[model samples]
Target chain A: LGPVMIVDTPGMDDEGELGLLRIEKCKEVMAKVDIAILVVDGTLGMSDGDRMLKKMFEERNLPYITVYNKLDLVQQRIGKGRTREVPQDSIWVSASDKINITDLKDMVAHLVVDPSNGRKIIADLISEGDIVVLVTPIDEAAPKGRLILPQQQTLRDILDTGAIGVVTQVPQIPEVLASLAKTPALVVTDSQAFKEVNELVPEDILLTSFSMLFARYKGDLGEAILSANYLDKLEDGAKILISEGCTHHRQCNDIGTVKLPKMIEKTTGKNFHFEWSSGDSFPDDLSTFDLVVHCGGCMLNPREMMHRIRICQNAGVPITNYGVIMAKMQGILPRVSAPLLGKK
Target chain B: LGPVMIVDTPGMDDEGELGLLRIEKCKEVMAKVDIAILVVDGTLGMSDGDRMLKKMFEERNLPYITVYNKLDLVQQRIGKGRTREVPQDSIWVSASDKINITDLKDMVAHLVVDPSNGRKIIADLISEGDIVVLVTPIDEAAPKGRLILPQQQTLRDILDTGAIGVVTQVPQIPEVLASLAKTPALVVTDSQAFKEVNELVPEDILLTSFSMLFARYKGDLGEAILSANYLDKLEDGAKILISEGCTHHRQCNDIGTVKLPKMIEKTTGKNFHFEWSSGDSFPDDLSTFDLVVHCGGCMLNPREMMHRIRICQNAGVPITNYGVIMAKMQGILPRVSAPLLGKK
Candidate 1:
């Protein structure tokens, strides 16, 4: 959401066993953050650890701004004691008095947010007057009396872009298309009904799955596309790890733990080992696994999903979501990815 | 050795609950076998399960022959009662009497052993009287007594192919090359010394690592190469799974659990999540991992390693051994792979 994600991390140079672990954890956080704010105690001045961290940031070419905290205390001792030296590019702030806190927020905003970057989701795909169709399948898996996040987000994206959205289930997709005066600018469907929707949509109209769009949005589309090809080379006793964003739904559990595994085994003609994970706490250890199959991640924010993807990429693991994997299995991946392919 | 490995499996289609698990185990064994022998009790005749087992083998297109057991009992009943119907493709054999067992052995030998497959490890790389240099590092990780299995096997392969093998440690590689009488046909090095050995070996000489060759001999080389690229893209907080073949060595523990992770983190400038596994029991649930780094697997047979590789490939996970990863990290992977690349 427009670069508003802020992560508050612990001090990097803590002492003792747990402190050492915290320092390691700080380094991990340091690697993932775009910009870091080093909070320093003004009275104590800068320690060697602070200098080391600043150098670490400089080595990665990661920009960092220092914050001098406890400005109130510094001010209280102004007449009696010497003022501590602050870095040239740093800001002075006090948590107790909220001194220069607004300036800190403004500085962060200036550094991170770029209005010209064009961060809109589907806005680039369609113009103000264009009609966009969304095919949502209402099945046992569908939540009671509510649309899932991805569908809602897609609808909102269309609305925000000033485009008209025609929402319907899989069976009504053909009728909905016929009833419209002009062909929709794009058709996005739930991945489960991708094959059916692909057939119903005309050749000229752009089509893609919701999962694929999310994958592109979340920064793992290339990896998902690349990993889809691996399904063909599976041999006996191959392992496939299936994960989902939400764990409680019976339908997702069935698909992840049972149906998908069965389909993969049958398609490859190989008996495979299957592992399952769900919800937000993704496994940290992934060395034993060969492949990771994730869900559409409707409930997960793009940042979380991207982190998961980045983790996989770093580990040299290939990862794909249910939509892409199923699309590949059904021979409709090329069609679903056509719209994005053109832009690339 | 010469089709000498024999796997004794339990009977399929056994009766009780425990027997059912054994039966499943039998089917797994059957899946890996080149040929199946159905030992039938001559007097009892073929049961429904036996027919089912035969059908299963037929479905897999696995070649099979039937063996009629208790030939002595059949002989005793010859003049007393109606004779059982024996299949045309069956042989009468008695373990106690040792009847027609030699024919069964010959049949197995005829089906499995073929001399023309060129099973030699590096025979294709060298001609008779050619010299090959091996660079082994006798570091802390090296065994106290002798060379590892891959090195020993490579030596044997060279001898079998009428090629001369010149062995040396990392420091002695340059001297060994200078002293050689002729240009060596190939140079192989322990994966740990890949970078150093790569620089010392002449550009014209063929070169490869023990792990890379083992990767090809055991299973998929393409997968390993593709997975190696993933090392370049790892981010901070990425998960890396490191595994070893055997468990007892303190040296491997330090490298796997300590040194390699440190090297990777330092090189990538990103803190990573790490997982470790050792010995014969690999983790079944590999879905949570992003990458798997394995050992050269001297303790593991080619078949087992191949199965592990296939498992990784099928799951769409990228895998590399310690050597390939280190070589790539050290910028020596291309030089080491040059010889194999030429063949390709």
Candidate 2:
């Protein structure tokens, strides 16, 4: 019972429309669980319905333990040791007297297995005491009173690695660089300010963006880079889906809805059909679209993000994010992603 | 005006406590914007407050356009063609008469820049018509009525890539493999079933788990693998944070709260202080913990997920997820992650 979900499903032997519906619901619930517990009335032993349930669990490869409840009644009726046969893994318990419940709980806990992995932001890229410069341009779209999640996280990662992080704005990059004792180990800028920061930061120092770092950290960097090339292949009337992970209030000049579409059209010099999707609902079928351009997924979990990428992959459609596309369009994709990608 | 957010803040010249607080709020608003529109009264021309606001914009590198409103009043008072000098980008308009608004909107749109990149699931791994076997063990935790997001996504990705995905349960995996015309290009199982699936799948064929693929797709697989080794380094009384991205109803036998903690304790043979965090609130200060074990982050966006990783990295704490840890604990990490990592 510890950390385990106990679903009290409807009787498997129920009949008629409502009963059938209940059984159907039970089946649906059955599809998702890791372990099953079949509680049987000990006096009656296993019924046909219980057998069907057991078979269902077996077919699904579900590990289960049978619980024979009302053990006192069974014991009294069968004279103790003469009780009916049961599965080896089955346990006998008296619900009223609380018999063998602890044993049942232990068995259940043992069957509940863990399935999981881990990650890092930029901690691996630099050494202790290394100076890391971050160019965060405060604009109308910047969050009020604090840095956005990505910036705060990047700086924290630097601190975690025992490294120095020099935070500055776009216009102050040159001054920040000039004031440094030695060339910083890495210069990470907001994707929107990459072009300006690229010119200001020395050619020898490694440079990247919050978006680019996230592209690799939370998603597939290599696939995003490859998909960026799809921009060139876009033909007239090509279909594109512009997807944003979170549905924040639309600003007058929202990047995903306005600027990105405009940029895509202007860059390709081709007319195309543009579609937009926001929040948790991504279309199941992505095959209709020639390309999918997504925002840096700050709001979505890794599994959802990867699922999206998988959807695009299955559809045979190329997908890129706002940062990678902007870098590619600005002709700095390679230069900005170099530090993270471990390439020149 | 299209998709742009217009925040009307208190006067920049405001003084005193409440007034200063209003101005502080205004400054907070200014930090997040892409562009600024300074509306000056034509009758008043440019006041000292206006100059200060413009200077703030310039210092922050915010592109702005000034509008001289009540042009009719200014022209009537000062005579036509005798207006006060203004910046080159300033526009003269009569607000009541709806003058030059289109041009102002265009200017604002021109200032909004797109900053973004992009991903894939298993579509990148399997080819068209390739048979990919999926071993999903249905248990009590399975969601009612439909497949979980990850499974649905993987299946969809298979269809998208023009590949054949044979979905089966763990007990039926042997039959599934036996029935196949030839060896499947890959066999992906739930991480919980990795041990059994690892034994069943042939060494000649590629094998991995959905969690392993996602670890790479949505996060750093190498980092996860490295962090998994940290399990061996855990000492008695070491603090561990078991973080989950979403806060679903805790089942009687919840994996994160019950199974995982118990498993860690059993595997390490050490007593540890375990803490928990779920949903959007990850502790900003994670330095107190020796290690952080996180869920796969299906509910969190990539940015937030990566941010948590960054936080852990910054805290100098080793972090691993449910899938990777399970594989590691079961001694099947190498076998389960091989196909995705491109090594055996």
Top candidate by DockQ:
2
- For A1-344, candidate 2 gives per-residue lDDT tens digits of 22334568877767678877977776655644557898888877789888988998898777889999998787787776454666779988888878788988888877764311145678789876576777766565654324466765676566556565555666656655555456678888888887788788878888888888887777788889999978998889999999988787453129888888898889888999999998766887998999998898875545457768988998999888998999999899888888877631
Cα misplacement distance, residue B246 of candidate 2 (Å): 22
lDDT of 1 by residue, A31-56 (tens): 55667888888767777778777888
- Name the lDDT value of residue A120 in candidate 2: 65
Runs of candidate 2 exceeding 4 Å displacement: A1-116, A249-253, B1-344
Docking class of predicted structure 1: incorrect
**Deviation in angstroms for B30 in model 1?**
69
**How high is each candidate's interface RMSD, in Å?**
36.8, 25.2
TM-score for candidate 2 (chain B): 0.68
Q: Give lDDT tens digits, candidate 1, residues B103-199.
A: 8788776665532232446767777656677665655455422445576567556545555555556665654554444577788888777667777
lDDT (C-alpha, whole model) for all candidates: 0.72, 0.74
